[model samples]
Target: MLLLFLSVLLTLIYCSHGDLIADTCRKTQYPLICISTLRSNPHSRSADVKGLVRFILKAALGKANTILNLANDLLKKTKDPILRQSLDTCISVYQDALDEIPIAIENVGKNNVEASDNASATFVDADTCEESFSNSPFAADNKAVKQLAVVAEDIIGSLG
Candidate 1:
């Protein structure tokens, strides 16, 4: 009985794909495609590919968040003109990543959702939009976002 119980527990662990990030991605058409791919091509390497993609997406989001905080702080205290310009550039890069993070995370959640929904199925193709956005150019206007209204207004004055 103990051996049987262990086997069952292992099976459960193997079956579960873990959490979905949100409701919308789970319900979308792209996730359905991923589910189909997972079902039809169980022996293919794409399963591993999808997992790797998801991991990268998560990492990118984490990095974006860290950079955003750093940029915000830099924008707040320093009054040096050259330093502010450099900070603005960094803010752009960080903001670009920040903008893409949500979509990438949604894709991860969507893939998992589809996988979960088709537990008995074999394989499905993964969607690549989120992955694409992860590689897109970074935007820098985010420094302004962290500024107080008066400070931001002043910065706008300087820009003009």
Candidate 2:
């Protein structure tokens, strides 16, 4: 888990483009992640606060989709019932998180930032998915998914 966080952290720390991205993200909890993710986008240079929020959510949504892909791939390869069930739960949780991202974007568009904030904070499902699997052989995969979820969570948490 630490390894995955650090790896993702590296991606956040470097490769940022526009100075405005870093400047705007300075108020965020995970500024590096915000800057790294936002600045790399072609549309970020002229993005306003709402645009930043949308971009941040989009980055999180991407991570959630990746988690879903990982879970689906693992599900196809696994014959163990326990692992299958856990992955199934993860799939659902990730989908929920994915759904939240679009709603958040819409909320931001409507100037309903409080609602967007609430939607962003609704990432407990991902945590629930991680805790579903204890010290099983699938622990590594669970941790990876958890880390990605954290990235998503961090992006949302940093929206303020």
| Top of the candidates by TM-score | 2
Compose the digit string of candidate 1's lDDT tens values, residues 120-153.
Answer: 1111101111122333122321211221111212
lDDT of each: 0.38, 0.64
* Clash total of candidate 2: 0
Root-mean-square deviation per candidate: 17.2, 10.9
Per lDDT, the best of the predicted structures is 2
Off by over 4 Å in 2: 1-19, 111-122, 135-160
Candidate 1 stretches with Cα past 4 Å from truth are 1-5, 8-49, 107-160
Name the TM-score of candidate 1.
0.39
Question: How well does model 1 score by local distance difference test?
Answer: 0.38
Error of 1 at 80 (Å): 1.7
